[model samples]
Target: MQARSVAGEAARNLVTGTTRALWWALAFVVLVGGLAVADARVLVRVWQDADAFRSAGAAVQTLASEREQVVDGTRCQALSGVAGLTGAGALRPGAPVRAASMPSSDLTVWEVTPGVLDLLTTTARPVRTATGTTTGGLWLADDLAAALGASAGDELVIDDGRVRVAGVYTWPDDGRDRVLAYAAVVAVPATGTFERCWAGAWPVDDDAAGLLYSATSPGADDLRLGQLNSTRGSGYDLSGLVDARPTAVAPAAAAAVGLVLGYLAVRTRRLELASALHARVPKPFLTWQHLLEAGCWLAAALSVTAAATGVAALVGSPGPYLGTWATAGMAAGTGAAATLIGTLVGVLTTREKHLFRYFKER
Candidate 1:
């Protein structure tokens, strides 16, 4: 009952010609929403790309630098570098191993054993049966497939292994890096010497270089000198990708500040909300009205902002920026509150017609 009464009072306060104000407020909300959506999309993409690039960069850094470290006789745990038909040996430090090499004029291929293949999913389902029933054999990046006009079942040949289209995948940097090719990685053949083609790591001779382990890397640090690190390159920079929480939260904070200021503005009006006690209406009523207006506007703004953020998350490029949703919510709440306060302040400073006459007579 109280809610309805308050709402009824608020409805009465709605000015008929203030369509302009309402429109202006709505326009502001829309603008803020659009920005938030754009920001979120950009933020998501940037974070993803940053993660990918960082992973790639880290891999490049690791491979490039590790060579120097190992050459100095530091005895990093080593694995084989033999390029089998699948080119597994040429596996980059932080990328997926394809079942066969991709047909690439620019990219090169090498071979590794089943031990080297690092399947993303815990259940690494095989692409084919021994009888060969056309169980998609080609593994391509989602971005790569979109780029190269290729689909599942497309036969791609690069080094030695023959691979059919198995599945399409997407990495964080797939769009930005322009890397499209098949990675041929075979699971351990049923009957191999080690029961796996890709030999991961065993504390072998330090001089050898297949897959090396070092103490500095995240996973590698856990492995003692004697035990080999089994985890393969996940084709992403996990550390960089997962740490986007901080970036995502920053926009929310800014929006919050905007909301706070908006509340103050609404209550203070253009005159003097500080003098509400001197006005015709009680201070409580004034404050209530302000709260109601603030709440409504804030709700509207937040809704728009959330939509914007979601859009941004999907479409925007990778980078650090304020997300659209957070921006909208904060701005709307603050704007509404401030407007309420400002109007109330102005009202407080004004004298009623009767009061003005009384004072004049006095």
Candidate 2:
């Protein structure tokens, strides 16, 4: 009966000691937990954006490759009186037409008809000159503009004539490092038959392909034409920007901070642990006490992290929240690992005999 009373008292004392120790470090725990939650949110958003960007880039690449194959394989001549070709509406009697060709020197020059600019409303807008005049000749992509050392209102020599640099524009696939430029087709010499055409009312019907093939060259089996629809693919890749290095840094730092704090907490209770050990408490019981204490601290930290995450989601934005079970699982796992590691280190370093010797010396 006496032994049972001592065991009960020891267990109660263990709980009280754990509570006192945790109270001293509650502020630290809250601070670390809050930081962890913030990092998790940022990480989740960045990862999602990165994945979306990568998928878009892949789609763009596939489309570009297919377009290249079509352009390389076909020799096409203009077939008059052909209607319903994809983007053929832009060629209405008075409507402007845009023709693109690569004559030489890896340069693609586009000649846009007068009203063609309006049709490109979704593309980057042409910038006006400082003098308030609209640039009237050509719009270059930023990379192309930089390559020529030209800006808005500047003049660039194309086919022996100077064309005004209207402004810079970017395509969605430009994120994949493509070079793009545009100009009034008249500025470029009437080259070999135009290779590609862009119109406002691009066709999406099943018969559109047949219409295009029949329009290019009827009765000529040697010539093949292919259509490239740029509107169907993704536009960007952010994988490089959101790499593993940047994503891992925050969680790693949090784990290290948590481990250090847990270690300190454990060290502070070494004397209590040694006393319990000297009182003939089984090693398993003592180990269980340490683990239980670590678990309590970890649980408290996780609770604070969850609460902070919920509050931020409610007070901040109206979009779908990104936090998931995986995120929570990661945070919990890291916190628990740090706590258990600290507990093991503390127990191993401070022996029961060392505590008794220190007490005798005191």
Candidate 3:
């Protein structure tokens, strides 16, 4: 009963004495830590987006640089041989088909096989006819649909054939000025000679190059072959940026806040701690009691920090940034460590003091 009474008295003294300091510490940690976390999250998201944009730009640039070489002449017959050798199966003739009143754009009408839509990235829908067979109609790129003021299920005349717009699609190497439309090979009139052939093959392979060389007509040296090389060495370098500022600032700020709060707490209860020790209180018990007090402050600080982060996420435009688990874990760990350090400092200062001298001076 005596021990219990002593413990209760110590706990009450700790709480009442340090309440103001605890509040100030909690507010400071929450405000600073919340801002740091939010900033880190935003930076990571933006860097990822920027890297993706850069990759897309690189692919477009590679395709544009090589387009002139592969698409030179009006009639390139060797395209069929090139297609067969590169495992693209067969080459189909394609031409630009447009409506009369439509504004001019760089649009190409391609005649493709049945599963060509499956090979390419498209939003095509399968239509089941009366015979129970599924067939694909004309498909337009997103920009092309916008330009024609058309949507899926709308009919548009391409060449002499009226076809339904199946869906909108995007190509990885497609430029802003380029749009593509597709139809079944059987639906379009055969032009006998193909103006261009769309074939898929990695241009860097020696086997592909050898096949392209043999396929070329003896006199048609103008038939050029271009390959898209989007492979890059290294992506974005986030190491330097992440490590430089936040890592140093967060821990330091936490430590500073902890030290100040801890000093204030110790100063307020100096006499109480002295009295308790002089009353035959065990050093370990006193230390544990002070630790419990520090823990309460630490818990409040963490709760406030969490709430602040959540509120920032809810109200901020573009939303609050959430970083990796490691980043968040490190931040929490640092705060805890700083708080513990501050608590130990206070405890040790009390243990080493000369209680009799303190009373004599008083």
Candidate 4:
């Protein structure tokens, strides 16, 4: 009860106490809270990018006779087994056909199997402005359409036949499309009878990552995932964003600050503690008083961080704030607690057997 009373009194002293070592410990608590909040904010943005990239980064694979690559039905079946592939398809490629609108325009045509462009080109967020229908015609890229001096209604006369231009889809020509912007998809036969199978998946796909990291024993076939388009992704690091693993940095730094303050709070005041002990004051009371002093300031710092969190949420930050608080706060809290513990431990463990040591040191 004496320790409790002393602690209670010291807790009151914190507000009126001079701003010094204990205040610095409180500052560290504030630092911990701020770090947690910052980490939460950054993680939120990264997750948004991750969700978008999960689809936009994937480009279908290719298997074409033009490359002298032959793929059979049995091999195509393997694509079906891939759990990561959200969409898979087989499209035939025709020889380069000359567009009637622009005689010099050598356009590639794909014999699309009606409706699946989104699934095939998973890794892109281009403004896919599609217009009209091919009615078994071609789907021209908006950019390609401009180049050919053609529109949705106009027919594209090729060597195979006069195909009616259906709709057009405009997406970026980044490595994710795996198709050419200057290409058209028509619903007719191409020169090639065999079709190339493509999968809508990227390396970040959890299905792919799961399979790769499975604890299952060896002898599993390695699924080779590749993209057809060979260009950089749409200005984002699709798979290499660093997470908050280094969040400990802030707390570790706070701990160093706490340690210095703890030294000041305890070592500089040993004589006072000795005088109290001589006056028949219990060592535990002195220890608790110092701890309470530390706690009051640290708790105040935590309060400031909490206030900041409220401000962030009010300003429309989608939170993981609680998570950051727990992570960073716990780390910083331990260090701050250790400061008090270390200070008190010093008092209890000192070799001073009498009040004479205090008087002599003074």
Highest TM-score: give the candidate number. Answer: 3
Q: Where is the poorest 10-residue window by lDDT in model 2?
A: 86-95
Which candidate number has the best lDDT?
4
Ten-residue region with minimum lDDT total, candidate 3:
58-67
lDDT values for all models: 0.39, 0.46, 0.48, 0.54
How do all models score by TM-score? 0.45, 0.44, 0.57, 0.55
Tens digits of per-residue lDDT for model 3, 276-342: 7778777677776776667766777766666554444334323224544335434555666666676
lDDT (Cα, tens digit) per residue for candidate 2, span 180-281: 333232222222233333322222233433444432323334443332223334332234443443434645655666677666666776777688778876
Tens digits of lDDT, candidate 1, 249-284: 444544544444454444224233334344645655
Write out the backbone clash pairs for model 2: 111-185, 112-185
Give the candidate order by descending TM-score: 3, 4, 1, 2
**Model 4 Cα lDDT, one tens digit per residue, 236-318:** 34335533445436556656656665656666667766777777777777777777676666666656766664454334433
**Which regions of candidate 2 deviate over 4 angstroms?**
1-18, 21-28, 44-236, 244-247, 310-329, 356-362
How does candidate 1 score on lDDT?
0.39
In lDDT terms, how accurate is model 3? 0.48
Q: Among all windows of ten consecutive residues in candidate 1, which has the lowest summed lDDT?
A: 68-77
